[model samples]
Target: MIEILNPTLLTRAAGTGALVADILHTLKGRSTAGTNLLDIDRWAKAMITEAGALSCYVDYAPSFGRGPFGHYICTAVNDAVLHGRPRDYALADGDLLTLDLAVSKGGVAADAAVSFLVGDGEHPESVAMINATERALAAGIAAAKPGARIGDLSHAIGTVLSEAGYAVNTQFGGHGIGSTMHQDPHVANTGRPGRGYELRPGLLLALEPWVMADTAELVTDADGWTLRSATGCRTAHSEHTIAITADGADILTLPKHMRP
Candidate 1:
């Protein structure tokens, strides 16, 4: 379902977005060499509970996944990209980690993700991949505004990834988010401009740009949730929840310190 949040709900959305961003920021700081993925999930649970919010993932049961997620957050490392279920493995130096989080508070939900290298690893390729996704996400956000079409944002994102020499995967991409986690108006990573749904004020969209180093194909791990690159090449993902307004798109998931 597509939801155009009212002014009151939009205010609540900003709060939820801040919580999501803060949780991710804290998790990224805590994740290092020898840190267990399960620990990250536990941390997420505690923070969410403390904030009096609900996790959109714990009870998330979709056709693609094995069952209810049963996890607080998604921890993707190295080759893994989307729907990464937290496991018992400890991270190593130079490991690329992606933390995706979604939460609801005051009856509104927000979602975001960030990919970064663990420890003081000098992996240039991983850094480049992460930068590319971040740049692509910015491009998508720049294209979002009242009267702008969804394809415009997708095209902007795809242009950045293609230019970075990374293959784009369409199996999973950004989507509308509001009271619930995933909503309608599926936003693909790549599409033609001037096509698809037109943007409007009060519309909330989670724009994510993810890419694999070599191929666009993906292989699901034995856990039946984590999606990894077919070639085992490193990957990166960047995302943010944006609200369309009269002036432009307002990024709701930016951390408190990063907000204007």
Candidate 2:
């Protein structure tokens, strides 16, 4: 379902987006060598509860996943990329970690993700992968404007990834998000430009660009939720939720402290 939020609803969406961003920022700060994945989930749950918001992950049971997600945040480390379910694992130095989060507040939902290195170390490949996703996400956002087609955004994103020498995966990508966590108007990471649904004011989209180091293929872990690279190469993912507006796309998931 494609959802357009009114001014008031857009304000609420901003609030939810900020909340999601803040939580992710906090989680990233807390994640370090020896940090347990479960601890990150606990921190997210507490923050969400304290903000009087609802988690879009817990109790989430989708066909692509096992039963309920049963986690507050997605902690994807190293080889793990999408739908990473928190487990009894501790982070290690130089481990690439991706934190994806979505939450609802005041009846609106916002989703975002960030990938970073856990500890101080020079993992050039991992750093490059993370930077690629971030750049692709920025490119996608730049292509989002009123009257712009979804394909334009996808193409912009794909261009960045492909130029960086990373293979694009279409199995899972961004999507429309509103009152619910996931919605219609699927946004692939790669697509032809000048196609797909045209953008309009008030439309909300979560554009995520993710890639594996060596392969586009993915393998589901035994947990049934964590998706890893087929070649066990490091991966990275970056995402942001933006609201379509007259001027352009307004990034909703940017934390207040980081905003100018």
Q: What is the C-alpha lDDT of each candidate?
A: 0.95, 0.95
Name the lDDT of candidate 2: 0.95
**Stretches of candidate 1 exceeding 4 Å from the true structure:** none
Model 2 scores worst on lDDT over the 10 consecutive residues at: 251-260
10 residues in a row with least lDDT, candidate 1: 163-172
Which digits, one per residue and each the tens of the lDDT, describe model 1 over residues 13-110?
99999999999999999999999999999999999999999999999999999989999999999999999999999999999999999999999999
TM-score list, all predictions: 0.99, 0.99
- Screening candidate 2 with a backbone cut-off below 3 angstroms (N, C-alpha, C), the clashing residue pairs are none
